[model samples]
Target: MPGLYLIPTPIAEPFVLPEYLKEIRCFVVENLREARRFLKWNFKDLDIDACLFLEINKNALDINEIHVFMKNAMAQNSDVGLLSDAGVPCVADPGAVVVEKAHELGFTVHPLVGPSSLLLALMASGFNGQCFAFHGYLPIPENEQIKKIKSLEEESSKRDMSQLFIETPYRNTKILQQLLATLNPATRLCVACDLGAATQEIISKKVRDWKPEKYNFHKRPAVFLIYAR
Candidate 1:
């Protein structure tokens, strides 16, 4: 029987993909262009030009159509690879629908090992990984954002659980300011940026210790975590 391969793509260097994930060709990707580049760069021996590509993104998610596509592919005993733009799929990406269907249809779902910014940040942040919560993106509005930050901080302090979250790369600085302004001075904040890359930096310091003028993450992929004391 055909299986659904949940392949993890490199978070930074395309050449870093695992050797075991090089065989699969029929792919359901978050972005066709990036997937193509990744395959060509990572697996130079394969003919990426002849590969199959099915896009499953937030803007165009026809669940029924995708369900049919995977079902037909599975019927032929041809494995379908699901690749996320970055990190793992279905964890902040849009492959959950197809993965759930695969399980319901009695098809095997194989999860291959790869790097995840969320996990990498948590592991390196020196926070409470056992009871942590991953909040993908914080609120955008001023008042609501403040309220949410305070609530997350409170929960982190009371439960001794870390709070992990991300921000749109462009809005990263703005969010950092909010964290500095809202979170308690004693709260430890971990700003992990450029994970899995040479320029990666993971700084864990109290809110009062962070200097807004000294740091800039304008368009860098970053993960933020908080552990209240």
Candidate 2:
């Protein structure tokens, strides 16, 4: 069973550790400190120094580093765990490159079940789940963001699909404002914030119904979904 394991870390408080985690001694992660802290927090008896941790650059994943990591793990016949900063690995994360490299090397990849903010938000959005798309992060510039929002709305209307995207925690409010101002009045918007946490909130309403003054998701992790049909 020496292969690559895609492990999920908790997105919020009240972490749940899978039993298989106890067996992983080698890890490929976005942040070394966070990964170590996660393991140590979940397993008090785990010897951090004895484990092998390879950090992947979140912004720009290096294929050379990934190849070396996978090659070494395969050569040693050791199980390697892939960890994201939170939630499942690969989805909306640079860890996808790691998973891709693992496959190219003909290594077994096991994906463990865990919370994913995108799926969770879509499930609660009351939108067309059967036909949906996750666009990851939209353009940051105000004009570009506005244009992207409009295009996504049009695409959703044309296909009767839901459009989902996320933004930097600090830019949550800014994106919300752009979404409200640019989308048609009849378009439905869903904002799921602080998912998996005690402060979790999900609100779905038409563009015209959203009350900007009543909500503040600034600096809070959130997912935004839109459906025009």
Candidate 3:
């Protein structure tokens, strides 16, 4: 392999799917110290001495530093793994930079089928799955958010782009509330939270249904979906 491997780690618990941990190398890991602790707890018996590993700590690295690290790693290895802080890699997450770099360098990449909250939410949404689109995340600014929502809804209904996206954990509720207030009330919304964990909750409800109650998505990773109005 002369490219990259976009790996998917558990969104919540490390041991959610133990098999995935043994399949590929892990890189761009958020916490090196914690990862060791986690593997020791679950895969202690397996020999992981030769696994490829890299760290991306927010406290230690700026964006450029991380980019440089990725560029260096991507040039030297073909079968290196890429991961995120949570959920699936590069879906409103990290690993995009390295994957993009790999593509530019003509490296063959493999995106393993794993715990993708986007797909899980879409499958649970009961929405028309024959055709869909995952447009990643929306940018900041209220107008931009509304515009993106409207565009996604229009595309999903008319142009057929099933809106699949997410936000930072802290801003998830705000994003949900915005969609509830700005988008059509009848729009089908699927909220997959803490996916693949004991507290995993996939709620396929209307925008209005979600507004009545306050939601706490602080400690949880969330995937949101809408199949147009």
Candidate 4:
């Protein structure tokens, strides 16, 4: 039977590809260049040119294109692989549309085990794992971002739930500073940077103890988690 495989690519160094993925020839990727690099690095023996690569536009997702892609693959009895630029597909990624289309078309969806920065950060956060919310990205504006931070902290304190969010690599320091300044002194904050890489760093401290000058997360992918009780 034809299937839709949701493959998770490595967020950083040290790539690991599953043995079964060798058989898949059709792939739906977020970025064709990055996906090609990933396949070349991990699947050294595989002929990348022979495989089919379909790039998905992150800014504008077309439902009709996805429908045709899946329908044709299913009709030809060819398994299709869905890959994100990094981490798991369909989670914090635009690949969800493809997965939804696959489900609607009755294609078997298989999710493989792989590294996820969010889950990794949560595990190392030492916060409430049972009740947590992942807010993808905070507001970009200073005042609005500060307001959002305060509200998230308030929600965490009232519900005893952990609040997780991410920021762009270049703006990591700015967000960190805002978080430190806006959150209450007693609120706990965890910053996990460059997860699953050699330069990985995980720091958990209270708002009062976070020394901005001592750390630099600039230009490095990071996850921020806050919890207040």
Candidate 5:
């Protein structure tokens, strides 16, 4: 049976795809244009014209189509690769449903090593890594969002675990402000911005110390961590 390779794409820096990517003939991508560009950027020596690209993002996911694609590829003993726009595939990203379908059809799943903003930020954070929780994204409503932040802070203090979350790049500044305003002033917050990229920045400080004057996350990708005082 052919295997389903989960290829971790680069987050911010230039492509550092593994040597094995050269062997992949088929790929499931979140964004077609970016995937093509990624291939050209990383595997400069390979023939880009010969590869197959399949789209499976939130807006355009067809299970029956994916099953057919996988089964046919498997019959040929050709491995199909799954690529995410950033970080690892299926971790707070698209591709989970496809992976689940792959499992249902009994295809071998192989995940390769790559940069993950969650783990990278956690490693840089002084919070408890042994027991932490990743709450993908916060609520949208103002009151509900603040309530969630406070709840995360309480849970962190009670369990001595860390609370992690992410915000869309455009809303980065708003979320940062919310974190500073909602969390306890003594609570330690870690803000990892543009992780794995050239302009990457990771800082851990108490909520009271996060001066608004010098911070602006307007359109930058970032991860957030919260822990007890």
Candidate 6:
């Protein structure tokens, strides 16, 4: 295939779908080890050598690196599958740069619609999903990050909008703490965790309702929801 395959994978459980075996010839993912493990378990019948592996993080992959991937993509008429470490290919995760590049190269890019933690969290958030904005990860500096959060809060409150974002898995607790500290107690907050996984959780409460007694957010990826009055 001249273009790329923007393949969508499950949020947490990759082995859930058996059809993943027949989906694409090669997987151009961030991690090949995990991919192999999941595939061997899910589709053990599939030939291992038939799959070509590529490891390129979205943040680290530059245009030149992308060109190499595209060139490899053109080698065979076989399709190239692009997946993230989690969730859908292009939502909050990697694959946007390659997708855009494939389009610029006049390749027919196909997106395999599947599980997206983003949309799942939003729908289950119980927020006003009709008006929502997904501000992926915020800036690194605390000041700029706070500014982005404030802007989202202001917009959500003024227009009754819903602001959605995710944090690094390890720093999830810290982001929750920041949200609790910065967001007004009166503001409505929702925490959606482990979507489509074995130990999934979703909670809707105000910032003021946070309880140190029962809340324990350690080593879990979560979606933060903020809505202005």
My TM-score estimates for the predictions, one after another, are 0.93, 0.95, 0.71, 0.95, 0.93, 0.85
**Cα RMSD to the true fold for all candidates:** 1.7, 1.4, 4.3, 1.3, 1.7, 2.6
Off by over 4 Å in 4: none
Residue-level error in angstroms, candidate 6, position 4: 3.2
Give the per-residue lDDT of model 3 (tens digit) for 132-214.
87777788899999998888887887865577887888888788778887778777788888877888877777776774475
What is the descending lDDT order?
Answer: 4, 2, 1, 5, 6, 3
Q: Which segments of model 3 are wrong by more than 4 Å?
A: 1-3, 13-28, 38-52, 57-79, 103-108, 208-211, 214-219
Task: Write one digit per residue (lDDT tens) for candidate 2, span 138-192.
Answer: 9887788888999999999999999999999999888888899899999999999
Candidate 5, residues 42-86, lDDT tens digits: the string is 888878789888888657578888888887787788888898899
TM-score of 3: 0.71
Whole-model Cα lDDT of every candidate shown, in order: 0.87, 0.89, 0.69, 0.90, 0.86, 0.75
Taking the tens digit of each residue's C-alpha lDDT, what string does model 4 give over 1-229?
Answer: 7899998888886668888888888999999998888888888888999998778955777778888878889999999999998899987776988888888888899998888899999999999999999999998988889889999999999999999999988999888888887889999999999998999999998989988899999999999999999
The model with the greater lDDT, 3 or 6, is: 6
Q: What is the lDDT of residue 14 in candidate 4?
A: 66
Candidate 6 residue runs with Cα over 4 Å from true position: 1-3, 14-23, 139-145
Global CA lDDT of candidate 3, please? 0.69
lDDT of 2 at 207: 96
- Shift of residue 79 alpha carbon in model 2, Å: 0.6
Model 5 RMSD in angstroms = 1.7
